[model samples]
Target: MKLSQLLEYDPIIVQCHDNPDADAIASGYAIYEYFKEHSKNVRFVYSGRNAIQKSNLLLLINYLKIGDVLEHIEEWKDDEFEGLVVTVDCQYGAGNVTRIPAKYVAIIDHHQKEIENVELSEIVSGLGSCSTLVWRMLREEGFDLDDIKINTALYFGLYTDTNSLSEINNPFDKDMRDMIAYEKSVIIILRNSNFSLDELEIAGNAMKNYLYYPKNRFAVIKAKQCDPNILGLISDFLLQVAEVDEAIVYNEWPGGFKYSVRTCVKEVHADELASFIAEGIGSGGGHIEKAGGFIRRDLYEAKFKDLDTEEFFRTRIDEYFDTFEVIYASEYEADISKMELYAKKKIHQGFVIAKDILPIGTPVIVRTLEGDIETEVSDDLVFMIGIKGEVYTNHREKFERSYQMTDIEYLSDDELLKPEYLPTVHSRNDGSVIDLSKHAHVCISSGATQICACQIDKRVKIFTKWYTETYMAGKPGDYLAVRTDDPHDVYIVERDIFFRTYEKME
Candidate 1:
């Protein structure tokens, strides 16, 4: 999983998916550079029916002189590779990557898990690009990223993979964009050289004919097999129409279909819709306004059983809008007659004083598995770390009223604050990452007043009073609760968390 693990093998081969894009090349290049720097023999190569012919990719390679180390391998003299083979941006043995036999196989990918069971693998599907994964891995190993070529390649990889960063939502992806000191002029040239004349014609033809569903004010277009970024371009352009609030554009490729989703309406988040379209079959995620996904053809065939792809998309989109109910917490009133009163159980939690960590008025981003929360450090701003290691903000006044600080230390036991991914705080001004757990101290609830709550039967997107900009998603069986003291103060409690921390009041 870590870059250091691969150092055991010598003469390592770094391979990318066939028809390598900027992301694949960048990821492979980073790994190659890391191994090379460590004095390990490594060669970055890609094997497929076609070589890198895309104009933008060619420009990127030429500008960085990566072609010096990168090889377009077609034929192999040896029946099997002797050393370790590390597949980047694509899983080993997947339809997308050519199966190069090796003594040891490792996968570094940022796609839906298609090929599993490999011992050496690092795949985070939520990331916009594999480059971010490699960057993080290299940084963990203390690999130097000061080289201009590597930095620029990594930046372009993320830029192209996330559709010029418009679709990037993951905090890690954002961190890479922020941390990398890349060549802006080179990136501009590579971006401008993205579309070739043939691709431009394909986009033009694809846009001329589109399916518009008036009821939903959405458009879906199936473009000719082209670069995945072209799908984003088509969707973005289509969404500009007066009647269209959302656009879905997709294209079929070698092993699967790549699609892009765009939305301008707050009621519908593009990332949520993108995930909905690819549920169970693939992976999808990005920013609220723009997002994209990939659906494996094999998975699609197995599930849909010969269903038309377009028809399936139409049905899927309809289901997305029909399945969820939206709630604006400020206006909705809780019906206490039907809901039971539930009070917070006395549970040990953690808290961090804002002023203690950073100066007042200093901007900081709280990074969690769920997402990033932006808050400026202030004397009154208190950050509460939940029992699950999740965080919520509170004012000093409310912190004193709702909970009491304890002298106990934050526990490190099985039933306590052992999170899968530990939370961190990053100063936006200085780009410094702070391990949040280090600053946290234990606290206990004051047995806050009961709230009328009930389990939701359907999917809900509630814009809680605290977070008015973005809505919190709640699935069936999740609790929707309204504070008794202030009915307008509404929120959602995850099902497991609700059961773990709350008890019905007698």
Candidate 2:
């Protein structure tokens, strides 16, 4: 339903989810503004156990001028209030949201859950954030958000919900971000605010005790009781490891298992992985790179009394690896401290060492949809000899055996670097820098390819506009010459080397 139809009720009460986040609060505020402009009496209120605890939220509330308008649900006196209740960023009776007992007018939410007893409900599951839904409503009514604070608030809500716009999958979310010129300075500040001291401690402990499984190149951690947001933070931290392409961090809460999955590897999509892991046991879904969900442990146990819950999760993840198809799986000695230091160093450098460089003239194969093409190793660059005979080369990190090419094969001394191989043109087209950074770490639709470079083991560099001087890098599927957020920057690599490699794997 549109705002015009919802505004028919006077003195409408806007209910937000309990323990509201930026999306929840900003959504309620947007509705309040729309109704207030139309000369309707509306109050934005939320009911929850904790007040806004995140420091960034405190800053957002003050900077966006939303403090005075939002009210605690307890502040409302039933005798003095009379109007239909409208919920935003939450469903009427969802466990995470507060349910108001009164005449219900409407429900506007972005989550996949459904609710009952709502007359006017606008539930669009594809939206990255509920704020996007509210923004659409107000903008549709010919309302201009001339207020800088409101615009910033709306933008902040969407940015955080979508993980700095990294999680957005729909045009609606993208359009909402583009609707107004949001203050990037504020966003950078806000993005760093969600983590609390307690949460940081949890992350530190989780990382310290992390279980690094070499068999699958995964970092798994179990934390004490913590906020759902903390899981995301920890998962992001784990992905920084060079060996760990995917990170799965979770905690057991009162209800069930709350988990967050993150990946910088080109062959693993966190959203799909989460869904696959939670299948038949609980509910899970999210964006391609970043996603999360919960599994009702009680319900799962009821259905599978003979299975261990933790084992169930692990087995599912292994199944996903087999199905997704990756290049080669080599075992590594589990090294927690080494990974910790590597993860720490990458933040400063913006890149990490991808693989050991092979000696010059060492033979390696770059897998393609058509077939594997052979090439020589490079010390400082990734080289791909096209089937039609075009040679592609870039900075060393751009070439990873698991992500950029195929397995390393020994060639006799008589075999030369220039084997008589056909150089067919790569099927994938080139992309600008912005397109590259947006998909930098997510899994490719196809399996990863292991590209061989020099024989020396060294640190791999990752560069962006402000990062290292090098521009292009390799992703999972296929393609070369990717541009990032900086218009001037670009990453070049060969395509289809890893794409569909799983199907061709022996």
Q: Evaluated with lDDT, which candidate comes out highest?
A: 1
> Once model 1 is optimally superposed onto the true structure by TM-score, how far is the C-alpha of residue 377 displaced, in angstroms?
3.7
Q: Residue by residue across 1-506, what tens digits does model 1's lDDT show?
A: 78899889987999998668899998898888888888998888887645777788888889878767789877555788889999999888775566888999999998766676898989776678999999999899888889888899999999988868877666689899988998999988888997899989989999898999999899999999876667777888899999999899998877788888999987898979998898999867666778787888899989998898789888999999999989899998778798998898988888888888888998887876566677789889988888788887878987888888976656553346566556788887777778887788777888885688999999999887766767789999999988888898788899999988889989
lDDT of 1 at 50: 54
Kindly list the per-residue Cα lDDT of model 2 for residues 200-270, writing each as its tens digit.
78778878978777888887888877656677878887888889988888887566777888876655657
Q: State the TM-score for model 2.
A: 0.54
Which ranges of candidate 2 are over 4 A from the true structure? 39-49, 65-85, 90-102, 111-119, 166-185, 214-216, 263-269, 275-282, 297-312, 319-506
In model 1, how large is the Cα lDDT of residue 489? 79
Candidate 1 segments whose C-alpha is farther than 4 A from its true place = 10-20, 39-53, 62-146, 161-185, 253-256, 296-308, 411-415
In angstroms, the error of model 2 at 61 is 2.7
RMSD in order of candidates: 4.2, 16.7
What is each predicted model's overall lDDT from 0 to 1? 0.84, 0.59
